[model samples]
Target chain A: MANDTLQPALPTPESPASSVSTPQAGWVPMVLIGIALTFLALILYIPAINVFYQAFHKGIGPFLHNLQEPNFQRAVWMTLTLAAIAVPVNTIFGLCTAWSLANKHFRGRTLLLSIIDLPFAISPVVAGLMIMLLYGRQGWFGNWLLDRDIRIVFGLPAMVLATAFVSMPFVAREVIPVLEEEGTDQEQAAYTLGATPWQTFWRVTVPNIRWGLLYGILLTNARAMGEFGAVAVVSGNIIGKTQSLPLFVEEAYRNYDTEAACSAAVLLALLAIVTLILKEILERRTGGHLRKRH
Target chain B: MTATDHLPRTGTAPWQVFWHSLIHLPWTWRVMLGYLTLMLLLPTAALFTKSLSIGPAEFWRIATSPIALSAYDVTFTTSLIAALIDGVFGVLIAWVLVRYQFPFQKIIDASIDLPFALPTAVAGLTLATVYSENGWIGALLAPFGIKVAFTRLGVGVAMMFISLPFVVRTVQPVLMQMERETEEAAWSLGASSWLTFWRVLLPPLLPAILTGVALGFSRAVGEFGSTVIISSNTPFKDLIAPVLVFQRLEQYDYAGATVIGTVMLLISLLMLLVINFIQAWGRRYG
Candidate 1:
């Protein structure tokens, strides 16, 4: 962290070292910073605090009642189940992809890296449309599956796919940087000592990247649980059968169930705050290795 | 270090050859390629295939239709405005985070990423509530004849909320890693502070700022959850492309939805490429 004094003129962006001995910055920079911080406080801080405040403003009884509603309950369960399935799958996908990406030499490697981030760069709605194009009743594979009386679109499978797609990049994005920064020396050393690749990975690689991996998984779980647009498109927003927590929030808000919507939003906001806390801890513990990219 | 730095430095070493062969195995390739192809590559390909089936003429017709064009206009213009606003404030916020310590600093820093971690729909709901006519911020501005919740302004607010973290995160790291001695050296050389910043500091920061701008822009463009809830969703007004795609899907116009989606995909991919390029450039220079 820097002192309020913006001393010694503007520093080059992206340097990690802090300067406590630098001269204090002029009042001009202080005024600018004051305005910026104030605006930020109004925008990001106020509304977030308001979510929790309003959720409980009327009383915990209303919040509890909203929580007990079957629709809300089902949405919570569906959200958790989606995360349960999506996180592990994407985590594995991320591990394999990161392992190959960080360790391998092959053509189209850059292409693969970009592809991994495709989910992040693409709109979630577009992601859902892509899935629907694949699995809808008249879709390429959908027609074939229809022949066998299968239902993917407007179902749990579709929701899972949508969630998985949106969260695909998290673990790999986090792990790749750490692995790249840490290098492959230990893996190579393990191989020379007659360790199998899997053994070497479990023993050397995983431990080295444990914090980064957990951070990535934490982020993946957050996104998986909170994904809205893609799931909304593919799940058809069916109240009980397909509604995830986010969809439920949207529905509850639209239907003027302000209590229910605010409560649900508060729950998700709490999850997000928890995610941020854990991330901050991991980042400090790891000395911010998780923030690097190459 | 470049990604290729991790590659075996000497190609002739036995260990290096063995490692290459292992990574080159069908199993490794399958695990990497298979998952992506199934989850990402194939589905995206299917989307393009579906969209292309409508042919260029029909695709052009739908993409350029009056309503679609209006939706595109709303989406792009508001996103650009939001990204621009974020560009300025994001740098300010990042600077404050890097250059100043304040009370609740950790809490504020942690909360910056609330947008990233929080559900977008939840953001939309909360934002709509707070900015609606009778709501807190809305009520304050209601006397001024400013309507936010159901207009393009609300859409921009939603986009800004979700995309703010992008600029702050991108620029903050660069600012943190900045060498203070460069500015000190310039000051020692008798250069004015403003001149030193303009001549020395601004050059390297530009690429990073551009990268942040591009990322925020793309994120805003692709935004759906919040905008869908905040905007009126009426075409030729605040309606955005993503909502239009959703609306088309709801109407069972799968082809129309796919076409709109395809347009979004192409534009986003282009923007992402630009962002990645600028980031790489920043890494190289900054």
Candidate 2:
């Protein structure tokens, strides 16, 4: 089954390179690739150029001034705070969930896995709405929480909860497959050596899955930093208080402050570029490890 | 290392111990299940209940209103077109990145993920600025009378931008895993390149491509950040279902918002179900 599937996809010496080199074959595929690249470039290139042009048109002075804007600074601070809190909490939750699912053969295991994956399939906006219904003033648990004066719908709590909710599945998704593939041998060996459960987990299991965990955390941080739909619904978009960078950008765009919005967007683009770079490095390292194991 | 380690001690009764430990743990699967049920299932149930209480008559009246119907039309049509475009181009890009070695291959591969990491609101603002008549590429496309900003086309472009990654990412791994020997064998046997691709390569890829297209479609339909920014959001023209839902919620018409949201949810659920069925069938047969 595996050979049957694998054979056709990879190129081999027996296949004449003539097919790809033929003028007719080359033209169609090349044009198709060209058109695809053109479309993609159209989407990314223009906006990138616009940001650079706007930033440099007034030179570094105004650009730096814009960055120093108090709202921009606060937005960045809040975004960092949100990511710092959400990524670690979700990573821990994901680790626990992964351990349970991987080690235990409980009834409803499949159901539990599916439920854990539910957040990935559901819309972020829906996630925010779900939390709101549970914790909003007019929601089912809202009155009870309101009596205690706990606010979760329009502030940092809501933001963190929403971010965490959407991001929980990432670490688990990465770690579970690795755990399954690596098996329980090392863990059992540690247990046999009189290691307690915590000791075995910390000393034996975690090191093997640390790379996957870091990958998941990287993805989670990126998502948390950029999340807009869920945050928008729950944030109330209060200028410096509730607004993150994305929300601030949206507000600026809505109010027709195009330059300021572009400036904030450049910051976001820079973040995205950094994330892409980090992901590439991680993926390359992981790929190298896998190849060496093979 | 052996089954003995997993077995119960002579009198310890492992199953009982497991049950006891499970019960004692504060954060067990049961608790997690309860939390998820409360957070996800219950609110969705509320949305459905709210929709149901409005009755079919009220639903028909509200959902079929000219403005609402127009919004639905724009949303689905734009999403469908965008998904179609993304599927084709996304497949090509994935194919190139996986199958070819070229200058800047690493750069292109990394750039393909740029859309995934970019914030939708940021993408929206950037695209709007760049595609406006006064913007960079707009200057070139303007002479051709192609206006991308503040139009339905602009909405489609934004949706395509955000969704392009879904298709490529979904398909690329499958492409990479496929072996080339079969194609070589076919070629040695005198099969044409097109024939080999059509008979061998395309079959396994169809399922993954379809899955990606479906994901892109659903994402485009639900998109709000970029669409709202780039498009005018004028009623009956550029407004999408999610945006309309937000507008209703902003107006404090909870019932109305829930109804609209429920309708969208139902449609998306149905679409996804169909796509999944196709995926299963493709995997089985293709």
Candidate 3:
């Protein structure tokens, strides 16, 4: 009723702006857009372009050469392996957490959600420090691990754990709302029709939240592969062994290997872009919960 | 519903409540809790315990050491400046994106999250290169004697870069939800654009902008990858606290690292609470 008292201009999906904000002074919109564009061009677009420009500045031969370096290839493999290990773990955690959240209400549910979101708030450096505290040679489990000859705090185990710590919340954050929206009516119907819980979940619920799951997994994988600070603290940055791509970029740039650094940066930049584009598509496709701050 | 749902709740003892919830718990809940305990809770507990093991005096002395003090000053001051800049320009950008039609608007809108989706290490490398003394933007500022890269100013640039999207994303939703008629009414009553914005728009926008600034400030303060790369890492000059923590760790000062790390984490956690409060206020007032 109060809405009817207002202008009847309904916002369309294509141009929500124009409807809510009626025609302004022509210069107003133009100048606003121009200033925004100019700001983005300087801060965002220029940096993006400079990465590509510097990567190719020395010509494609050197660029290709940099990409072919043993350490560079090794870094790429490390990142993929890290993502493969971390994303699935977080995905399972997210799915189970979301399932528990949607299927029942429990005491301390809100507190649990807050705990899941802890990594998002904590500094990555601090997060790494936490892992070191728990697993470092001088740490709580240090002696036990020493006796067993298991190494952490500077190895693949530590790297995977750090990546997992940093990227764990994405899948849960993405899925919870989607699960809430999809509801349980279909699952209940399937159960009523003699389908087992697993069958109903696999056949009914999984399809319902596939887009959300994909979005979550996409974000988780990107974060897992690109993680830097925490992994840097724990990975020991041993070239060809522990350095992920992001760490490799920093090391290369610091060593004055501009071509190598930028080439590797180009790959990570592409991952970032791919993450962005796929994010856009998923967001549009599902009208997703990405808009909300998780 | 589980069996517990049908149970009478009046005057139930706490232990009984716990036992009821425990025995009837679904497999998913059990798995989820176990994972979280191993992954999130234990690490967090370890951090606090290790930091506290040295006692409060030691924690204080290490946390407030001269270098640590200077690092916090640099981190908070630069982050504040960056967040303030974000608040101003973020409002303008969100306004334009949600209030005006333009070519590539959707793309531009999505670009705001590039800082977020893009890895900070990548962002750090790019910002350092592009703002170096010989680079494009740095060259433009060179004549003004304004150095950006490898300085404290570069730290601010990085903070602003990474936290750029917070204010815009926060404000965009509120701006999109606004009624156009209110602005028209203000304008028809002889208010100028600035006057209307000051009187009508800024009121509702204040909470969101504050929330955004708080969020960005927390993010900037806790930032590691980019600021560590961009700044000179001088103890009293450009070095931020997270970098300082990393420095201490490299020197085998795990205790020093933990103390400083605890301080940084606590500051961010405080900021998180403040942001949530502002968001709650926004919901209430809006």
Candidate 4:
């Protein structure tokens, strides 16, 4: 089962008449690659390198000085806390959701699938607004919340909710396709062998999907940490209190605190870099089969 | 009587069967669906309700007002342009990554997702700096009397930054899995390389390309973080709908914000539906 080759949903028909051809060892392909790389450098690579250069251009003195500031520290702490609370909850939820969707054949399943992806398609600002409509002072449950003296909107909880909403599909999206392809043969065999559902899931299913699950968690953590728009509306951007790192970057940049903004941005970029590295490591270790599934 | 008793049930009541099935469902389904309903379903439902509450006339008025209309025009047009640019360049990059071997090729392949991994605010800040007149690339282009940052072009660039990975990632796998045998066959038949590509290679690739375009379009349309910083956000000039929605929320204009948010939401939903349809069609026919 572990060695089984799962066919992707869209099967490419092989034409027996012809063998696939490789590019000629000549100048044309080289020129094409060069041109493509130039565009990529302009659009993606240069801007990224510029970020690191600018952040450190003033030397480590100001960079270290900015990192030591209270607001910066608070923002980093807030961002980490948000990811801490959000990632685990969503990871567990994603696992359950993927398992159910992959194993069951109920009606409206496609709708459920689309709903999971709704966050990705929806604007983050709108995501914040939806929560406000439900939990804001004049929201649907506003009066009850006020009566209970509970705060959601303009608070940590609200920011976490928005972040969770934005990053919801990551884990499930990663795991679902793999689970679908893996099928239930081993699972059924486990059941026949008198293994309990939980046992089968732990011993059989989890092992198969762990790599995809880890990839999803990494992505979810990154997005949750970096989310700005949704959390911006919901968090009120109260410095030293509610501001996440991304919000700090925006506020700092708008206030013309380029040093602080760039410093904070560099931290986030490092996080992103770390994510990329880990992703690459995972891809290499897993033979990168899961990478293509997406 | 014996036959009747032994025969399988053919006409069970629908609701009764549904109830039985619901009861029989595992705890996993209940937990998953229940959680999704609370966290996702409820919030989305609230937006729909609030949007509808504004009365059709008011919703239409706000949705199509000149400012709203201009924001819509800027948002959709720039997103489309960005998506198209990404479509062409993205395919090129994917082709290179799959078809070539060069120094730092591994690094370049991995770095394609830098935009995805970076915080949008950071990306925005970085791109803004890089494209500003006094900045690196912008300094070179400044002599040409062309400005990138603080213009509609800047908005497009930001959108391009955020959406490029979508195009590349979607198309890369298909390209990797492509059977080169057919192109070889065409060549053996005395067909030119370009002709072989134009006819054989492109037909199968078109659907994936369109899928990538649609996905990139949706992402670019909804983009706000990078765009807000890079573009000047002047009304009817570079102000995008998402930023406008943020501006409204800041002004305590909940109703107005909800209306605009609803508009963005509906349009995005339509796009997503279209994408899903295209993907389904590709699956069936591609």
Candidate 5:
């Protein structure tokens, strides 16, 4: 609220003294900032340090041995397998949606764009519920699928579906803008040169949007691996079976295996760090290109 | 040139006609239609059908149950409080990142995105560990009569953490795009910093800031992963709507879960609509 009061004066530049005299420089603001930042630091640093410290307590031997546990290995594999399946599926879906939106005109274009952005607005936990409502035995489609003897929820398929549903928007959101900005000139040029649609897409369009697509896929991978709410609801947290890395950490923490939980968390954190680094690199490169053009 | 001059006057093949007609469809239209039909329409329809098929009486009974009502209160109030907190700091952080040259700028910038990168469950677990009674920060705060972990405050804190990046990232680009000359002009005119910021700079940034707030609020409302881990799923205390939905599903209360979920979805949709309206109004008048 104090900040809201200060917002109106944002355009003005005053002497340092006068500026400090404003409401934002009051003791209240200082105290608030201190509390906030202190809380932030506590929230960020403690568990992070705890995990790494726990990991390194007996050096790499025990830590490495922790990774050899059947549950840990299964979690790692499941996380990767989910990402592997979901990312590609979502990427293809995103690409097709982007390509369709980019290249054709029919009806309800704006409506469709909003729909493409839907998953971003919806809660992941709710998304999992939707999947269950549709695919669970009591679901509308669930009965139909059951007749075919197909089990979706409470298994790997459910995990994949939930991840893919939430991750679908990433690649499309990234690629659509690039395609919109770049226009269809390159594709048209390729078309005029006697290239087929597939060739033009691969040779011309993909090259132009590869960075965006990769960035999108990278984001998707990070989310898929880190995804908890949707997966947890559907995966049933069946130990090594449906347990993702995040779920493994949660289960371990719940089961009072503090050391194992922290170690698993550290593994997830490491993956997060790597993705963050990659995202930074890609963002910087994209920003540089945009700057050059401007 | 006449149409006849541009093209050979020959009968077109059926396949050629079909392909040309398909290709000639407006790109945006085709993709948009398909996307909406498949992604948005189908899933939402499924959800709604589930919600509505139980009829109004059953829906009301399920939705107004004590547990459901409590979850709603917790979800909305916490989300609102968290969003308000994050909005202020999010703007400050964005401004600092964009305008100030400071030590550890890159680190601070990256740190702002930690919530976005970290898994919500991990974030929740981390927060719980750090704020528990025997935890590092908890050890210090415990003497002060402030218990964080497994409280409403913990829910708010976890929600704030997970939703932080939305507001900051949303506001950052807008802040960066603002021309510096406006501030300089206000200063040259002898306006006080507060006056200039209030009269000139604040109006334009208001829309983006509000958008950020709405996004943060929505995210906090729907946040389940971190909140569940940190808050201990205590109903009527720290229980959020999404967690309630999960609990309902686990208990095989499909209709009840759907009713609660639909309420949340509707509320979020309303908020988003309001935000969009505010953004449009701001663009037109602010």
Candidate 6:
């Protein structure tokens, strides 16, 4: 664990950028790798495996039984609906923001960038508080909403808003860097060739950033599906009505239905695993394309 | 023709020129700002107004109440401890992944982000299960009398889990971008491995490590879902600030909740400023 990177790093006389291709540092790298792996196994891998093992420990009977619960089904539907709404909304905003940021330089540009990143830095719990402050009864717009007979908090609308806020920055964050790297040269060329702004965006810019956009959408979807803290605050954790899968796990555990909780968790864990695998593929794919383009 | 073709040629007012140029951009900045305001800015502004509507004296009292202070203590101390732990192991993990050759490496590299993708509620459940007295790892430590789950230690573990990826991801790129000739130069000059590391490697990497630690600390401080479940939520013991905010909200003490939320918001924003400053410093020096 100590000085793991301090190897006998002798890059073969001017082997351009391939810093010490071979590890001849004997047992050091091996020992370091072992320590790191052991640490990760205890902290991450073992805990992750525990989720699946606990889910099916009572055999497939209870696992399937837990999944068949109506609330569980509702929770799954609610989660997908939230993701379906939040991901596309943010994806479009991400594209628009990326295009605007990439196509021009202006005052407050850094400020705008920072604002896009605000939701990420914010605590999900506080994010809920903000929304509640705005839309809850006795809130700033409480009278207006009450006059209109609207219930925003403790319902699907606020849940969607909270989910959107928490996952909002992902698409923009992922796409901005890619667009900045690609620059506006291609878009300008398309415009000079008499293409409309939308045409230039769809034909030239979108193709160039499709992988990045997909990467962002993948993260946004996974987060929207898995968001617990913010959604918990805003959704009121209503059993069959507002409970997303993550909330269902909490409620099930609270009810001493460990099997149900673990089963629902397994579903989310599967989603996360899928997200991770796709993320890896995108990173590798983007890496290859980025190298070629540059 | 493009939007600029209609611009008045001779006496274009400055404001008119600004508006015309803005409209002619490939994307509409209006919609971008409008969305940004509606989604992020407006809600945040509401929180500020609501929280600050109460006079400063009262706001200060609520934010620094004994219970609130204790929660902040647990939140900050535990998060700092977790982030420091991550700093050590995260660097080691990044080092091994970047410099060493090993099998299943790519999968492990990707898995560092598991905490980001996996729901925290699931993480909390599993951690509680695995660290309970009769649980897998807990059973081994039971005889030693070190309780983990349902304690502050459990909260720290949860924080550590979520914050691990930040440090690794930040430092990994910096480590990869480093020049090897400096280290080779030091080695060729008869510097010991430890000395070469301290003198040649670490100085350049310090800013990145600090930035990662700051980001991780901010993240851990804001963490709610997992810590809420892992900790018993005892007021003066293991409770975190975010959990405290939830408790206040649950009790319908909106004022109490908003005050604490504002304090946490300010601290998290301060952390961000510090991170940005560190990155700028690193860019200039490293």
* CAPRI docking class of candidate 2: acceptable
Docking class of 1: acceptable
Q: Model 6, range A1-294, lDDT digits (tens) per residue? A: 225444554534444323343333577778889999998998899999999999998899999988888989999999999999998998888888886776556577788888889888999999999989989886888789999999999999999999999998787778878888888788889999999987987899889999988988998999899999999998988899999999998888778888899999999999999988988788788774422100
Writing each residue's lDDT as its tens digit, candidate 2 over A75-120 gives 9988999999999877877787787677656566776776676665
Docking class of 3: medium
Candidate 4 segments exceeding 4 Å error? A1-25, A292-294, B1-24
Q: A67-182, model 5: which lDDT tens digit per residue?
A: 88999999999999999999987887788878877654546666666667767778888888888887888876887898899888999999998888777788887887788888
Compared with the true structure, what per-residue lDDT tens digits does model 3 show for residues A212-236? Answer: 9999999898889889999999988
Q: Once model 2 is optimally superposed onto the true structure by TM-score, how far is the C-alpha of residue A95 displaced, in angstroms?
A: 1.0
Worst 10 residues of 3 chain A by lDDT: A4-13
Regions more than 4 Å wrong, model 2: A1-33, A103-108, A288-294, B1-31, B52-60
What is the interface root-mean-square deviation of candidate 1?
6.0
DockQ of 1: 0.45
Give the least accurate 10-residue stretch of model 4 chain B, judged by summed lDDT. Answer: B1-10
Candidate 3 regions off by >4 Å?
A1-23, A288-294, B1-20
TM-score of each model, paired residue for residue: 0.91, 0.87, 0.93, 0.92, 0.87, 0.92
Which model, 4 or 5, shows the larger DockQ? 4
Q: DockQ values for all predictions?
A: 0.45, 0.37, 0.50, 0.47, 0.32, 0.51
User: Where does the lowest 10-residue lDDT sum fall in candidate 3 chain B?
Assistant: B184-193
User: Which predicted model would earn the best DockQ?
Assistant: 6
Candidate 5, RMSD to the unseen true structure: 6.0
Lowest lDDT sum, 10 consecutive residues, model 1 chain A, at A13-22
Q: Per-residue lDDT of B126-201 in model 1, one digit per residue for the tens?
A: 8898899988789999999999999999999999998888888888887887887787776665555567768877
Provide i-RMS per model in Å.
6.0, 6.4, 6.1, 7.5, 7.1, 6.1
Query: Candidate 1 vs candidate 3: which has greater DockQ?
Result: 3
Angstrom error of the Cα, residue A95, model 4: value is: 0.8
Worst lDDT run of 10 residues, candidate 6 chain B, spans B1-10
